[model samples]
Target chain A: MSAFSTGAVTLAPHRVAAMVLRYLYLLRSSWTRLLELIYWPAVQLLVWGFLQFYIAQNSGFFARASGVFIAAVLMWDVLFRGQLGFSISFLEEMWSRNLTNLMISPLRPIEFVCALMIMSLIRLAIGMVPVTFLAIAFFGFNVYGLGLALAAFFVNLILTSWAVGIVVSGVLLRNGMGAESLAWTLMFVLMPLACVYYPVSVLPDWLQVVAWALPPTYVFEGMRALIMEHVVRVDLMVEAFVLNALYFSAGVVAFLQLLKSARRVGSLLQTGE
Target chain B: MSQAAEPAIAVDQLVKVYKTTRAVDGISFALEPGSITGLLGGNGAGKTTTIAMIMGLVTPTAGTVKVLGAEMPRLRYHVLHKMNFESPYVDMPHRLTVRQNLKVFGRLYAVEDLDGRIAALAREFDLSEFLDRPTGKLSAGQKTRVALAKALINSPRVLLLDEPTASLDPDTADWVRAHLERFRKERGATVLLASHNMAEVERLCERVIIMKRGRIEDDDTPRRLLIRYGRETLEEVFLDVARGRGEAREAAQ
Candidate 1:
């Protein structure tokens, strides 16, 4: 390589954001990958919507069950996709050894974590629009909270998923590709246990404690409070917000630590690539 | 600094140990820029280990690596866009088409007039026909070309290639070398090539460094080493260094 007194390369946050937006754009442009994220969850929503309609007739909530359920499904659908985002992304870079190349770049640990979170948020955001419309048309799903609950759910979904996202990244960094699938299933199982729709009080007291322990439980409750009761429930939102931030912040710190460690391992094993 | 001067790449008193074994032990060398230095050694020769450290992908246990005049794993990023690397040890995404892969990197590199850049590269590398195909479908040689294209996307200042032309046929290999030579001439990028192909290195590299068991054993111009070691050509000289018979030259020196 010849030498040049080149200009300094500055790392721009907006550039990183644009890179993230482009990834989201790619997801939107690709029908199959986008569909994959929404399809199965959409099916589950449809089946559950019909079943709820049969069980609760002429009920004000029943008439609106489909829409709310669709919303709930749309909200929860992000779980798998977001977890997949956290898990599979690292594997892709690692497998390609692009991780090595990227680490060498101006992209710092914060940038990496931030980019992943942004990607997940974008997946949840764009993918929800069509599912929302589909639910409204097909099953007469309740759109009562279309404006507010959806927005609240949007913020909460991103925050909580980030919490889960932190844990997932930790797992992926520790193990190779092995923990990624487990990370996916972890969310699939945890959301239901978190009682995304029904309140934790409906469950046994011990299970309720477990539900309260999960960040999704707070988010779901915050959504229900905003939609069902029109109450601010600032306490719940504050708690959920703090918890999500804690999870994400801690995850980022841990991820950075993992990265620092990974660099050493990468230095040793990631050679020659 | 007197004789062991201006290494295009340098590692000093390097040491990295896994849970059990020391992968690299006190290895050091500096490569002069504008040269293709070969880092040759066996599977666990610490060749890859050393490269990772230089790339800032791996943190050294106790050592320092300086690449392109910056202490690496720290200032690596400042010089990142100026450098590029390719290795058969790493694979590209199979699901994405070659053009898609190129686009992603092209954007990341912020290449000017990205479409035009990709078009020129696709043609220059003879990758036009398979550009739209998924990378998984391409023959090994084609994959190497795409990887190389990605490496050159930034018009790098430092190029580290590990077994760069491994899977290509002789014609394509020669073509790749010619393009590399052109890039070096035009861009003045420093190149450190690690390969098993002695002929490729001899043809492309102005200087060479051979490693056995994680330490540099021979550092010289390929032609002088060939004649000084009393070998007809560089390839034969490689066998002597690799197989433990080239030590006599070091002792004589």
Candidate 2:
């Protein structure tokens, strides 16, 4: 009886931190989900990447694309895979009905979001090598001297994807399998628009404006700047960081509100409800 | 029984409505420490709904739920860390092994002597053989055992079990009952069980609250309710309630 009354035990900051650490366990446990994160980008690197090589043969694309592998392509992998990390982990919980276990536990809504962010980060971290390896193998280019920006770009990709995941998770919690499709579809919509395969400069100026509004666009933009210009553009990094923060914040607000709305509607009682 | 005794769970006019339907209509009941209260109702009678509100898993259209006398969700975390739940309908992550699942839950509850706690349950529940197996691979009985083990990780003061033995064999079912009894004796914990097994109700619960159409139709000890209602067993009592007969039987009295 003494134990039952211990503040239902809200997740303290350390516990929240620990949940973020523990949340990455989901990435290790599900290889199928992990592979899904790698699969799409791997396909793009293999198929379209070689075509880019065929076109770049005489166009000095090799020298132009030398740093492109690390700068542009790898970061895009991080975004797609980061979304995968968040979407798959959540979908796993919903499919298995383990969301109730999480919801009922002392873990708060913020803690849950933070945990998803942690998982997204881990996925993005692991994806860097494979994405680089695949594109390097396909395109035969040098993408070094960008390690410092790599870390920053990775963080931005992870933060952005996790923010996307929170919104996706809220919908999935309400509609079950119906909302899971968005997990894949969101990456699909963002992929071409982010101009990952090409530069934003390659796109028309107005479309680049739309790309600028997206965090991944900034991620690639910063990565491309590091590789092509070899100069730290403070403004671009700040823009990426701000956009990622905004998305992450929006996700947290939406998740918290939808979760409360869901509880008021009693959907937690029945996943379908 | 005096009302002064510390109540383990107190629900004050707890009401829940789903759309226009009153899922649980103005129900109030208090469970004393160490008592096992059985909630009995047919499908859609709001048994789960009422329990959900109490667990802070559902919001009442109107009403208050206090567990261990703390207004829920506000004090929800403080109390919930000391609480545990098991339901046949819920599942753990399929990719995790039984050992991993238990370890995760045990850590969540922050149970001291973690290894000892898990080892004890594994032995008591005969889970040592497949403790390394993924939770998804376990049979229904094994999964329930794992779920039960997960629920008891904290040695909770309050246990909420929904269909504790839904798919278990008689032997496993008896083992679960014995384990629960041992837990209750050692901890003096309160258990609120929602089950359809009448024999389980007769054998376990000292007080049975029968619900119908989102309200309690009757509340009594199983044997007393049996004799008073001209029934021979709890199964018959349940048949009456679930078939919409308990209300009439209560009126006749």
Candidate 3:
């Protein structure tokens, strides 16, 4: 018997890497897809950067910390790209009617998820790097100046995005392309709740409770604290990490449950546009 | 007396119920190693659903499916690497070149010396000419060959094929059937092919299992089915079964 004949399902790193390689091949093959990764983020940065420039000139509060809006925009892109990176990679398989092929392969669902996460990171890097540099060049706002705290913000926000991505993927698995719009629109539902632009205090008392429950809210609050007060809120970072861990776990459970349901319904064979 | 060897595939009381629809209902069969069994059925006859269950892609509501002695969808990992499936309905990523798609599947199966394997499959499937072309750009016959190459990349012992030659031309379809026979003969592989093409089934399958509305209607060799149904061709038998004629008119009397 082969090594895989064991009772427990072992995670094969090579299979995960192979999935990542597949996505990379697809990304490189299409010039439009490659350009798209960098396109929207750059535009978002340019628009928000100039808007912040105007506000900073007129308002004393904005003038005190001119990079705040620009920083927020860049950070938000990390979450957006991270979620899109994972969900779109999955949607690509469905769009091509390849989900059944992948489902039947030796590659496990967990391995597939890991590959999506890694691809999310790769895509986030490609999309954000150029735009972050543009923020420095055009608007004198270096998002990297957040220094070591930037790592915490990224990890926390990306994890939250993966949580949302997995949940959306589960819906798509059960509902096919009909629910694909959740990939793009679902994140925005969190945007207001996440308090992406303003602090949690800006929300009404009742809504602030909902905002605080979201991991991204903690990251944004932490970001503003660092930029404005120049004091890193280690407590807020810890809270974000803890909430992210919970949500990520829930996402995995929800995905596996939906996959099981799909199999029970025999949708695995029929999933596509 | 010697005990019979374990079958390559064993299904006992296999059933899958999608809500109120019984996609596969309480069917049973065993396929010996190195055997090619054609699963014949109409559109809603559960052939694809059965294949999906065996591949561990779909969970059976009841009954059990064992592939190479491993129970499906639970212990599938034990045998997944040793089995592969292909169908015209499923597709590979379109933008990736044939060689790239092969390479990706090869790595997914953790095949040793993937480049050598890809080269051999390209040669065998006559894919060398268009190995670098995007898969979407390939003709239907070409795409079928590439799908076969992908399915065979793992050198699977158990192969499940669904309408493997559905859209191919006569020449290409015949070529594919010949290659499949050669592969089975050389590797001692077991194949469970589900197809509507009666001629292909008669030529390739040693045994055929006919299903109707999630139940097996008949199980026998092509020659026997012809005699049993009092028909000159398997297509006639298929039509009779599909049209709700259970047995030959004289036999029913």
TM-score of the second chain in candidate 1: 0.89
Identify the superior model by lDDT, candidate 1 or candidate 2.
2
Stretches of candidate 1 above 4 Å error? A1-18, A21-30, A58-71, A85-101, A104-106, A144-146, A202-210, A226-232, A267-273, B1-7, B95-99, B128-134, B247-253
TM-score of 2: 0.90
lDDT of 1 by residue, A1-273 (tens): 122223543345643653475455446445897777667766777787776667667677756433445556666776556666655554556555555545544455555666777776666655555666777787766554456545555566677666677666655655555565766577777766778767778999878887876777876776666656666666776676677777777776776676667676654243223
The digit string of per-residue lDDT tens for model 2 on B125-167 reads 8899999888999899899999999988888888998889988
Which runs of model 2 end up more than 4 angstroms from their true locations?
A: A1-40, A60-70, A134-144, A198-209, A225-231, B1-4, B249-253
Per-residue accuracy of model 3 over B99-145 as CA lDDT, tens digit each:
99998889889899999999999999999999999999999999999
TM-score of chain A of 2: 0.80
Task: Report the lDDT tens digits of candidate 1 across residue range B117-188.
Answer: 999889878889998887878888888888889888878878888888887889888888898888888877
Report lDDT (CA) for all predictions: 0.70, 0.77, 0.92
DockQ comparisons of all candidates to the true complex: 0.40, 0.49, 0.73
Scored by TM-score, the top model is 3
Which regions of candidate 3 are displaced past 4 Å?
Answer: A1-9, B1-4, B248-253
